[model samples]
Target: MRVLSRFKASTIRRWLLAVGAAAVDPAGVLVCAVLLWLGTAGLCIAMLLVSREDAYHQAIQVGRNLTLVLERDIVRSVELYDLSLRAVAEGAANPSVMSLPKELRNQVLFERPTTARYLGPITVYGPDGTVQACSIETSIRRTHRPDVRWFITQAEKTDAGLYVSAPYASRTAGGKIVLALGRQITSPDGKFAGVVVGRLSIDYFRELLDGLSVGKQGGMAVIETNGILLTRLPYNRNDVGKDFSHSPVFVRFMKDGAGSFVGTATIDGVRRLYVYRHIHGLPFVVGVAPALSEVYAGWRWRASWVALLMALFTVALAAGAWSLMSELRRRQVARAQLQRMARRDALTGLENRGTFDEVSRREFLRAKRNGTPLSLLFIDIDNFKAYNDHYGHQAGDYVIKRVASRIASRVFRPGDHVARYGGEEFVVVLPETDAGSAVLIAEEIRLAIYELDIKHVKSQYGRVTISIGAASSGEPDTVDEAALIKAADMATYDAKSTGRNRVCWHTASNGLNADEHIKNTEPGDQAHP
Candidate 1:
């Protein structure tokens, strides 16, 4: 009976132990579940954002394709009008092609007995701006041809051939619009005969865009290089000849050489995806907008199903992870570390090239809008390859890291950045800094690196040196990250060409008209032998 009592007590102790193991703390479980839920939610949110971005890009491509097709048609139509005008001129000279317009036909066949009715409103003005033949009924009454802006400008700019003016309202014809194409006809002795003026139909463009097979509730838009919207449906029928002065897309469109955008808009009481692109070949922005819901209609059900399934899975996983707080924390740490590694350079702890590019572009735009001077420096280690060849690769890496760190430290300022662009190359962006200040900073960096005293056995001077290219611009219209980079690269090339361990400046103007080549001048550096 005593042994049986001891066995019962032992069995009671084992049962209590099992009960303690199974009775997990509710608070710990709750915390873990919350963490897991947050992590899963974050992952799903990221996926959704990426998917939306992909859709936006795809829509933009489709819009650009449509715009290009429409632009080609517009060009063809304009060319046909131009060709017809040329044919009239040729016929006047050789009596071959086709007949002139109704007005000219009436004058030539039924007019005066003295004058052989002149061809298509030929206006001959001499060097002194005197009218030799004022044949155009519209321009005949004007006393001084030189007073007109188009006439003086065209004559001053070109010596020969046809010059077509963009559509402008004819002030002489009661504000009637006309497309004027001018050809300077020269005499047999090389003197000027006259300017053969041909008229083109203005409503052709408006009619052509109206006929395009744009989707329901979709609009065809055209914008000029100067942020002027030539035409678009629904949003602005009045905008047919109006400029979008306050449109954000127009602002970015003028800046980007050729690209597309997707933005939110409402038309006809429904929201839509406004897809737009800048036509590179034409001085116009062409866009095709389709309802966002319509474009993604086919994928809507699939996306909804996926979202619902993911939500349910997330809930179940959260419930199961309720008791694993430590594991959840561990995973969070791992994810953060991975994200850091992806965005940062392993060598110098600076931003990676891709991240640098994005940051630089943003900074450049901010500077441009603020009308502040921005500068870029492209730096390269002279004889870096030789150094790697002589010393170990480890030593070469050390040099790169050291240089990057120095740059990061020296150019420490708000909106400034230093990055290792690639092997043996580094780029620095200095915001609100001019070319002079940028050159000074570059010299400091160059001298500091030379002070490193790293042996370059293969170098002519048997020492370490760096080549720097510096360029800067304050003109908001001219400055950008790419322009700065190009200027700096050119300066770097000059530094290399003249001699290493020096700072070179691109002395070109904002308009890029100056031919001032790089001037490589710095302390402790001589011209190449």
Candidate 2:
């Protein structure tokens, strides 16, 4: 019972050792690295997406703020123009104001508002679309400006409220494009008598937009809601007064009084982020469009660093995994080599006695349980001592190695075990083999050794040969591993004592007579003496 328990424990321990040896696998490390890389890449992409969204929102906020400031500034400028026009209209309608001297009358008409830079003197055009009064000119220049667009526009409008005209070339302001603000003058009877006008020169808007920076390829613009473009920074003179009613910016993001969007531009196909404010009470929309590339510049820079770091981290991880995997493989190979050295004999490179003992015992128990026979062969190199004395111990050792190789080649069954029993002796354990088969196998091994024909000058045969004693458990239930090895050993002694190169087979039984054990008696089964 104790021996069986020990054998079971030994078997379990060996299996555990085998499992431990397989624990370090390179493929496992590579798989783990790949999973980690996937996780890291997913996280990096998510971070980049979130950061891009944040950048867009920040650009929107910046653009909205800029549009608001511009809107307020524009509103204040228009209010000033309206105030100047009201002053001019009241002066023109009042006889007391007209009766004043030229310089004083001009002061009351436009001097107060003209003190503000970019605000030109108000000009008064009579109902006939002719110039009746001018503040900058010394006298009324009787200018029949009937063909003027601002004059005709004011003449047609019956509403007394302020009117802002489309951008037009000013013959008075050196033909520079100017935006005009006008209001109809009414007589005491409340009929249109004349128009009071103030021209805001392009320099005013140029000065307003000069200090602001949108981007290298981006611009800020003010456009009349009715489709006329007033002005744009990065100013193109040809774009002033251009119709933009069919533009996507006017049709899409121009709704809801205020809006922002990111889209491709129809002009140059460059992508942009547009933020616009339809000045609450005014007819024009103030818009700031920053290049999409500029808006996400910071995010792109930061993402590049983050992606580089992640790539470097992934590379480092891969290198580490590869190095660890290589080290594990190297150790596995070394451990396997050590295990092979531990199990095999140093001289013959075959399973040594210790491994054979454990394997034979296990096979014996297996055969007993299955009711099958087990066989063993004990081999001796005949005349080995004489060969060593005649040649050298090196030749004897060479012969031992050659004999072990022959036995291993012959015992090709997976379950059979060949081992070096001791000096000049070897053992082969043949599982599930009967006495007849064991004797036949032993005869083949003896013949193979005889075929070697190594010189042995001290012996009678003058050649190398081996004696094989093969034994089988005919009654496996009555036999054990010890009895099988003992019987094979006795048979080998019998063969050596009688004649050199021969196979002696024995049917092993516990406590049986040695003579009775030798059952497979062939032609030369006699004692040598």
Candidate 3:
């Protein structure tokens, strides 16, 4: 049985892989599931095919067994007829036995062998082909009259071999069919003297076959090698002596000694699986032909159940695979949330410096490819150290948070980003912004943070304020992420060095001439300086 192939070990490993892959590549789960199902289905089909073939072969073996029993019985009957014919032929040729009284002659030649019901009386026919004597008062059927085939064959061939005639209707009583078994008697000079012939009732063939237990659509037959069907059971009177020479299966029966085949009956077109055996000493072939439907009936029942079970199993497996994939997806969601939490800065609720570093590098490469300006803003609480010492550290943290929120509110663009660059400092990245626009955005943030009016008694402005340094790079290939950050940091130093609470920008000529410096030194703010 190839049933083990229905579920392969390799596909089980793939099912495991599908569960693991849900988090990495969600589509792989569905793809692997489909493959697993296809693999299982292929295995199941292969097993079912092997099983069905096994059932067919077993049926053939069983039919052969039935043919074996049938051939033995029919061959024995033909042999008995031959013996009876030989006895009468030898008695007819003897001068002494021919001269005895009718009762004694009949007693010597036809006592037991001719008395059986299946056997008709044995009779002697002279060289002139007329019946000389018979065991019973009835003579030979004489249906063939002067040109009987058995008499002609016995006279022409001096051989002692029995001539078993093809079936013919007997004129006696009911006009039943009979086979004439003939043997020739020769004189001392080897010339034919007479012949002995015995009649074997064709009814015996059907009666014996009917006793066997073949199913209703099943049958047994004794057929001549030349395709003459002697008798059949599930007995059909019309099918007796029917010629089957045109059938392909019958042609094989003529060519081969014995074998089997599946064929359709021409008269009724009933398809059957036929198993035949050639009786060793006779011209007859015994066949057991059961309907093809009958042969496969048991196999189909088992296969239907097996197929149903396999279908239910596959459905359960698919349902299980989908359920597992769902569980993996839930874990994937949880992992993603934890990952996002890791990327955030705890104090500011903004992306941390690690995210800023990676994002700014990608934006730099994009700007280089598209030939666009990329800008960065480096902001600092100008008097944060002094303010931390003057107010308490708690107030210092409060001021830092307020300044971070104010900067975030001023910078708003879909592709722009902000992150806490380090302690008391934050950085913002603006894509597709020139140095002029970047300075304007930086000035707006500086003014917004200075307007908060948080107290700083120890600093120059004596209030909490911010200094923002702006930098721009149109040629990102020459100035990478490091160069962009350095420029912004130097610009911030320049702003605080002149006076706090201002915005300053540094750039080259086409980018803002490196010597040029722009500031957020508005008229009212200089009075504090």
The local distance difference test score of model 1 is: 0.65
Tell me how far candidate 1 lies from the true structure as C-alpha RMSD in angstroms: 41.6
- TM-score ranking from best candidate downward: 2, 3, 1
CA-lDDT, candidates in order: 0.65, 0.80, 0.78
Query: What shift in Å separates residue 386 of candidate 2 from its native position after superposition?
Result: 3.3
Clashes in each model (backbone N, CA, C under 3 Å)?
A: 1, 0, 4
Off by over 4 Å in 3: 1-26, 111-115, 138-145, 345-350, 357-376, 380-417, 420-425, 429-467, 471-502, 505-529
lDDT of 1 by residue, 1-529 (tens): 9999999999999998866544444455665566767787788778776776676667667776777787787666545544544443333333211145646653442232122111124444444456544345565666557666556655665565456555566665456444565655444455544444544434555655677754676666666666555556544444444556566656655666556455554224445555555544446566677767766664565578768977898767765664364565676677777776777788888778887788778878887789788888889989888899889899999988888877777786767788878888888888888877888888888878878777778887677788998877653433568777777777787778776788887765423333355567744853220
TM-score of 3: 0.72
The estimated TM-scores of all candidates read: 0.38, 0.83, 0.72
Candidate 2: stretches off by over 4 Å:
1-24, 87-114, 125-134, 138-147, 158-160, 186-194, 253-256, 266-269, 303-315, 476-478, 508-512, 520-529
| Tens digits of per-residue lDDT for model 2, 1-529 | 9999999999999998866655457776777778889998999999899999999999889999999899899898888678878878977877677678877877677765544677666788888977767877843344787777878888888788888888887767767788888899887878888899888877777778777999898888888888788778778777878998898877864567888887676656778898988987778888899998898889989999998899899889989999999998898798898888888999999998889999999998998899888888999988888788878888888989998898888887898899998999999989889877887788777767767777777766678878888777774433678988887888888777766677776643433346544543333342120
- Ten contiguous residues minimizing lDDT sum, candidate 1: 110-119
Ranking the candidates on lDDT from highest down gives 2, 3, 1
Q: What TM-score does candidate 2 reach?
A: 0.83
Q: How far is 300's C-alpha from truth in model 3 (Å)?
A: 2.0
